[model samples]
Target: MSRAGCSACVRAQEQLAQILADYDLRLAVVDVDQLAEQGDPLPRAEFGDRLPVIVLNGVEHGYWEVDEKRLRADLDALR
Candidate 1:
């Protein structure tokens, strides 16, 4: 996630939330700028200004947008 209020990020987050509503998912919003300011591992260097990055199991799943179909496929596989 980005602190710059990226529109795409916001939309993706909302879409993901709706998609995973039926499942038990632990979604977190990480402000890259804040993380950088705090010297966290998730800095802009890695994530950059790309808003609404989806990370699963410590690996990036998607960025800028939520691939709903792909996400559903992944979740189905998890089940």
Candidate 2:
């Protein structure tokens, strides 16, 4: 997920962790600024502006916040 120092990202991360506790999932946190420093080129354009993004199976979910109900449903469907 694209996340910076956003409180929403923190909450989302916690919620998602709780939701997926039953399953074996991998969560990767990529710092936008750090990525740019490493020559990511268009960091903001790529994900900086879109902090708190969720990528489900390589699909861009969205930004802003996390929906607990929706997340649970998605997880259920995956199983």
Candidate 3:
């Protein structure tokens, strides 16, 4: 999603990355604009400007920010 113009998006990304780091996981940032341009289903067509969306195991857990408590729980489940 659009992390460039949103401060909350940046913060969410940083927090999610930090949390996942403890589990030795790396966060993957997707270039949504490119996907949207290509007419991807979950991009510009559906999501629009809502960004910094957190997709955990292919399911949306949060948007515009990372749900820290839920994220911690989800990541912990893997361990």
Model 3: CA > 4 A from native: 39-41
How high is the lDDT of residue 78 in model 1? Answer: 81
Name the weakest run of 10 consecutive residues (lDDT summed) in model 3: 40-49
TM-score of each: 0.83, 0.75, 0.79
Predicted model with the maximum TM-score: 1
Off by over 4 Å in 1: none
Highest lDDT against the true fold, candidate: 1
lDDT tens readout by residue for model 1, 1-79: 6556678777877888888886777567888888888878556777776667888667788888888888888888889
- Candidate 3 local lDDT, 4-59, one digit each (tens): 56687788778888988988888887657677667775665555567777888878
Q: How close to the true structure is residue 49 of candidate 1, measured as C-alpha lDDT?
A: 62
Of models 1 and 2, which has the larger TM-score?
1
Candidate 2 lDDT, 7-72, residue by residue in tens: 877887887677676677756766667777788757556766767887677676667677777776
Rank candidates, lDDT, best first.
Answer: 1, 3, 2
Count of residue pairs whose backbone atoms collide, per candidate: 0, 0, 0
